[model samples]
Target: MSAWDRTTSREQVLTRIRKLAEIGKISDTGVSRLAMTPLDRQAVELARQWMKEAGMSVRLDAAGNLIGRLESPVAPDAPVLMLGSHLDTQPYAGRFDGIIGVLGAIEAVHAFVSEGLVPQRPIEVVAFSDEEGCRFNKGIFGSRAMVGRLEEGELERVDGDGITRSEALSIFGGDSARLDEAKYAKGSIAAYLELHIEQGPVLESLDAACGLVTGISGPLWLTVELHGFAGHAGSVPMSMRRDALAGAARIIAGLQDLVRAEAGTPAVGTAGTLQLFPGSRNIIPERVQFTIDLRDMDMERRNRLEAKLRELIDEVAADNGLTYSIREDTNSPPRYCDPELMDVIRLEANGMGLQLPELMSGPFHDALALSYACPYAMIFVRSKDGISHNPQEYSSADDIAEGVELLYRTMRSLALSIQGERSGGKWESTTA
Candidate 1:
């Protein structure tokens, strides 16, 4: 335990996260720091200041990823051991969703400095921007830029206010014209580790403090539009009216049933957003557009489920005498955590007497983008009631502290392993 003041470190981490939460405070407890917003910039600046205070060199990448680097004294040129997550929040989001991972990395670095210890490999903490995709309808913007996966046309995509992503990047101090510079060369990152709250109930249900993520479920987002005919609500009889909203409602219910029937598997579906044209009490909706977000750890199963959904939508639309169109907005494949890193995390959890069950992440994360650049892993602390992306989402302070401690230990172990391999020695286990 290298003389690390656990209590003080925990307090500091919590205090910083709380301060950032205030930047975009909504209502009594929600957060709304959308990507590239003024509050988002404030949060990034605050994180940069904290990184500097922790004695790390800090800078923003071309895509506006706030990076804090702690160079290793023994192996400065070794591939960087990266630690990060996003800072942007969903509309009225919880405080912990992406905030903890970035701040937790900083706390880990501060602990090393406080203990007069320099890791064997450099550690870099990154706070990625626009992970929620709330404004631009595209997630993992900064991370995709880092891996050179972002297409140039994506910059032209506009937000609700008709602001292009390119313009938003400029506002965030990121030059989309120079986005290529943000790409990391292959093998430059040794591994990426992120700590986040389990936005699901698995951990809390099992009475566990934290869990090691096995993989992140990929999502396929589709905008389904049903077109029928608008009619006077009182004048059109239920049997004669071809109401698009009614047809959409039936399809949404079918989707829920489909997922429920796929029990024992990781498959899930949601009709998160629905809009009705001619939204009036006196008129039947002629057009209904709804978003379907389906996810599964198994790609095959996910695809199968998607096919079934398409069939259901078609059948429902036909039965209701409505025309239907389905457009795939985005598709991200499932990403598995590195098995070797999973082993390291398991060993540490057992050594610390922490309950660390393996779990799959239903929500997508920045790690999915970073996976293209390097091996990645995630640690999830228990979220109360398995809730997130809302004001009620909560993770206890003690649970978050445990997660931070695990992250620190994992980074330290990886650093040492990299150093050992460089010195003509086999990597040694860091567990007792």
Candidate 2:
């Protein structure tokens, strides 16, 4: 049997993720498991038990991340290695996104336990909270809090139906005290590793099993409100009207044009929402509000795009003689994982006979927030058709196991390097 086969079976990883999906499962091509909901609570509980079964003691921190720790043969706070991903999903999320990371971490621990394989450093597995941000109005809510990025009173942010943060978190444990306990002490972490599905078609299309990401994009969410007159739709002359909707319409069109011009290929913009004040059948929309999401992995490019988008909003708003103001819903700085760490992951994959693709991630992830706190890197298993945030998202059993095997090797390598067990600077040689 191969090293991968010896530690964890391909079928076992798939079975775990598929089974996690089946519980509180939905098939609308959308995953309805929101944060702290009954489904969400159940899934975390299930994985927590699995972590325990893998011979690691488990606990939930103030950030709601599930932590499983293995004692190092060395000592207390011995340089630690962290692995795992988020457990939350989109309103309609697929099976693998975050769950795969959690389960793979479990398997890695199981591998370590079964073989009595103790690297010089201790390893920890964590399942992050609210990574998908499908519920409670904030994605990565759980992670932001851990790194101390989430400010005081910010937890009061509201959701679509006016649901407050307190109300949302209440479903999980209803204790603010517990929430504070979830935070990671600054400087306590040695390094962080997250294994997640590619959530895109790149690896599958390339016939590769894993992607070594160099960077994860930062996200800028903008809300534009256009002010104008709401008059009778029928009697209003097109020439005399200052339609907020019309102004909003031009801005919307401009958004697409701007997105095309600026983001031509990998750059992306989404206007996922629009609202009118009265929303009446005959009322000329006097007020129109819309949302735009802009993302770029390159910080310079991301900043440029944000500045240009703001400039366009001003220009577009002015052309229609409409007053407009933009409210920033969220802004997460772009994250570039340590290239030194990325090279290690790639080397492990190549050593395991898997071709690794260098890629950039478009989605905003909890990893970015954690990156601010420590050295972070990720392994992406392929998703079918580049699909994510929906039920159609998928990764084959074989692909997931390959990603896990790669993570296992990398973790072992990092552990050795941290403990001074490995002599050379890095793992550069590969047999394959």
Candidate 3:
């Protein structure tokens, strides 16, 4: 309110991404920029040009993560103030998800050059690869390797179409063989920050422009298979017919009831995908399979839900004379952001006269994965509604720019603080 003017001029970054959308540069489905695809390739190249245009050196790592390095007044090897977000998006996904963070970092660099604001440590902006997990079932592939967490077996995970990880890498113009090389030495990085759109309607509903992430919830992908005998619906008596679909239908209803009854206040579950076998009107359907997606910030609750689901699946399957099996396709533990860094983010936002909410993230993101590797945090900007991963997803240019301003201030402050430490100097903790 007091003449807020510390914000950087980063309209160009927003303009560039919006321009990409205006043209056929984006996919037909509102947001279809999958990693390593032609669109992702174009996006990375654009990032490279912007990095140079912003007066920073640019390079790509083995895992296809793009980096732009800006020098600081501190030592050449000063602990870097790394900021990043992914460039790839979900099929027909929204514009802001991970794209904003990457370009916003570029905007931060441009701001430094334009305003002649030099911090103590160098700043490195990155665009991580394969964050959406649309093409590859595994997500945060780039960040996982960055943290030295990708086991060798993961390299063997073939995609849906029988494309090996190595082949997919080559198709994307990167070497899958060298993904392990993407790992960095522990403590080599000083800190990391990311900016993303709040995929939920929380901020927009609350009329807040910016939100600080306290934690990101874990996601559990589950597959439930129910098997029973195929038979004629008219001839086979209810007692004689082994109705798999019937059993599945009952369990599906039960699954919803269980979630509604026991789920943590805000926790939810979705049986998004379902398949019935042998589409014949008369014949009783034999096999039924469906997908379950469970999300929660509390790991214990997630585990409990999973356990209860397994028991329910077994009980219902056996009660109806059906065969069934439960397997956890994938699960990531909940990630908590650095509390001290979060405080600094809040302080910076308040100093800038921006209102913010301390919120937990419901969606899984690359930032959650990277938190394990660094003192990482995220800033969530308001979305039009709670809608994301669709073409209708939107945020105003002014709001986007405001978040960029916050990103810049927090990053610069961190760099200067690190530099101050290395030089045996002190930063005056100037919030604004």
Candidate 4:
């Protein structure tokens, strides 16, 4: 606790998390604050107040991102050092999934200014919109928009409630038509940093409270649809049945075997969602739609498995007398963290008497999108039982403080090092 005395306050960080958790509270610890909803806006306003109290000029960008700027007194026009994650949560998410990152960043900047230290480059704390993407089925909306990586027809995407993304943005105080204006210019961000829960058991199993991320293993998202003839379940003979759900089930089960083939590797796949048309007890399923999530640290291996998966789908569809189609929703290559930035983090952690285990993140974060715009890195706090995206997700306050303290120290060091002159609004790299 005394280690955090110089900068971050463990109680303050935990208190804020508790308050935010009550906004969309469900069961005991579950939250359902989906993006662009009234609850999400309320949460943003609360976070906005905290940012303002931390001495930042805040605004909501055209892309629905809430940004708090702490302009450097020395180089006001220099490229900024950005820190943040998303505020929106999954339908049945825990409070700490994306909450700690935003609050920890605010705490870091708050402590920095309180110490009377001024940065060379401006620093911004952002709560990016819709990183969960559960509502619109497209995650990282705000980050992608800022990096100028948004896909075509993104605004037209609809949610389950039939609200278009354009409409949601407008209602959330953003101008959908002006999203292009929200893009940060090339080199506008000197670097990006984020803190998040491990969402896996690796850290806990290794007896570590905090870890350094080596990189993010990108996810390949796909939606597969199978169509076949429908008939009475009991009347249709098993051999003559044309069952789409059966075909889907086989593909989903086979997917597990396919990824398992690459034993001892980080390769993995999941069919987390599925829907059967005419879902009646006695009706043969005529259509089935499901989602596929595949990930691997090695792209070549992932690609090889993907080909095998497609072949499995083809075979299943043919044997079931079904026609199938696979739609690629997202295909992102793995993005590695900056080595120099990792050195900065490692040095800071060492000073704090921490030996953080380096690991690759299987779940993508806002940092994944920021990677395209500038150098990016991440710090991970240990998750209890490695649970996330669910009500039971938990991280100890002590462990979180350790992560935040490290983040504060790393940010402070980087901010001070960037102090000096600027070249065409971009600060020169000091860590040669």
Candidate 5:
């Protein structure tokens, strides 16, 4: 018999995934639940119901994080074991990006409860809000708030519809005024674990069903705006016209050249979004705004590339006679998974007769945010074609089941093992 056949409810997990997909579902398979929207709240409510059924005491924190706690009879006040991923999807996204993680964790906890064996520490499953960051231009809002990592003026940031994050949080049943109350005291969390789709082609290429995350390459998000004089396209001369969009195009292309030079490494750069003022067929573009996403596992290399990219932007703007401004939206350094947790997962996978490949995640997860507060690890289910944040993203049921089984085993080990001590502000696990 297979190792997961008796533990996790694969069918039940899949059912809940399907049900949640139907909430803000766009295409037959696409989901559009942006953060803090009414549709996102509906999905949160559904997950809350499932958490209740799992014998958890659930609550929505002031930062809009949906948390479900399973108290440990042995040490109710001890540091809690947290497992979760976000539920918010990109504007045009697939069904399983962050959905499976939350559902899979709930299933793992439910299975644990069914055994009637008390854990050594409390367990909490969280569905972090705004992990997608499509609406407010900031991701991991919920997780960051929990760790007191929020920046000033975040509540004032406006979305496309002119709705501030503060207003949206209020409508979603969150009180930003009491956000400090949601912050978890240091050492209050023993560790964090997240299960998510690979979101890249690594596992499928290796023919592995599940992989272990070595570390996350946090992205540097920047918004650049260029200004120039607007004129009639027909009247603007080829050499004399100062076109902001032209300058933006050159900088975007130059960014590609900068990152591609470091080929064979994890370095990557993208200008995913762009906008132009007076956007007309005949009007010369006066202003252009675009976003930059630069990531690398190596901090020095990433910083170097960022400097070069900035220089490229300056050169382009000068050549085009355009003035520009840049705003740093988010700058997160790389975060590694705990060695102790990785060892636990490795042992669990070995016992299940599964081969787990170790890979670095190019895309960050909520685990990256929680990594600041506690030791964290991630289990990645094979993503078909390595496609994510799109309608075509998918992972097989068998693969997801395998990943969840590993998570369940890992959670059980950490939750029931002898408690660890906090040394030098880090949780040092004594468990093998």
Candidate 6:
């Protein structure tokens, strides 16, 4: 039997997930482990213990990222192959969103040790911090810091309770002032791999056990303001009134129409937050502000959609007699999966007799941030009903096991290939 087959059992994996889920258990049904919270710290401590038990050296980075390192006996200074995912959870998030990836990685390393196999490159599993952004309203804090992309001003960002990110980092045992120490130099990491739930319905709808991510969609956030003259609701004639809310509504409708037209494509748009000035029933809305979140896997298509939305907004403002302003808050470009890493996943799935479908992730992940520093790839298990970010999010144990097995196989293959490249020998797939 293969080392993958000899890894931890499905029940063991589920048990670990359950233990982590209990850390921030908000109710009978959900978890609330926001980053830098007491529960978040507890979860990290537990992960540190697990990593130690797996025979790896573990430490917390300056950004509070939990990193477990297993050095290769032959080549201790080789570029590390990194694995794992975020440990933070959304508000009332389900148990499996980020938990599975971290635990699965620990299990993979344990399997490797159990088989007494040593590769040429070190393996590092990192459970990144603040991925949900529920507390500070900014995501990928740890990964961004690791790549040296974190802005200094971001450390001063205050949460709902007025705790600055730096303060929270200090409480969580991280030195925000020393985040530069967390940055990994170029060529320090060979690649990054993560196994997470699909968080969507595509794989479940097709009854597939796993998916190979093609790319991660990047989100473009826009804050739009429409201004018009406030009029008395009872005295103003419908034709004479310049209603900002009405103009905002038209623009939102247009956005929906445009997104619908591009439904089968990678484009998606959402107007999740809106506010009207003087929110009174009898007052005409003089100003309206709304947030638009648009995402796409292709940067060209995403930019085109942005242009089309701007054009539609201009038309809506002109037709409604309202002056409009748009401010782009964020524009994150899409991260395509590394082709060679993707092929390794595909070949491993085929070797294991598992059906792995290719799918683009609509939701962003830590892997997207890691892509800036190294070649990154992800594997996704099917989520039940494609639900995520909710207490109802779920994936079956059988499917989770399949994903973990695939992850182990992929890591094993990468290790062998790294060793082969170092020794000037052809790499052979262990799965074959």
How much lDDT does candidate 4 score?
0.91
Best by lDDT: 4
Q: What's the count of clashing pairs in each model shown?
A: 0, 12, 3, 0, 0, 0
Report lDDT (CA) for all predictions: 0.89, 0.76, 0.78, 0.91, 0.91, 0.89
Q: Which candidate achieves the best TM-score against the true structure?
A: 6
Question: Could you tell me the lDDT of residue 285 within candidate 1?
Answer: 92
lDDT tens readout by residue for model 1, 1-432 = 445577998999889878988988996778989999889999999999999998899999889899999998888888899999989999889899989999899988888877787677898999998899889987899998888888757899999899999999999899988988988988888889999999999998899999999999998999999999999989888899899998999999999999999998888899999999989989989999999999999999999889999999999999999998999998978989988788888877876888898889988788988888888899999999998989999999999999998998887777667534554543464434
Q: How would you encode candidate 2's per-residue C-alpha lDDT over 1-432 as one tens digit per residue?
A: 224563345666777776687666778445677777778888889888889988999887665677888878765566577887877777777888888888888887787677666655678898877777655655787777777777777568777778777676766754555666666787776778888888777787788878888788777898989887788989988877767887777767776776688643466778889998888889888888999988776667767767877887787667766788899988877788887788788767777878898777887677788798888998888888888877888777777878888887887677655533353534332222
**Candidate number with the higher lDDT (3 or 4):** 4
TM-scores for the candidates: 0.88, 0.86, 0.87, 0.86, 0.84, 0.95
Per-residue lDDT tens digits for candidate 4, residues 17-108, read: 99999999997889999999999999999999999999999999999999999998888888899999988999999989989999999999
RMSD of each: 3.2, 3.7, 3.6, 3.9, 3.8, 2.2
Tally clashes: model 2: 12
**Cα displacement (Å) at residue 81, model 3:** 1.9
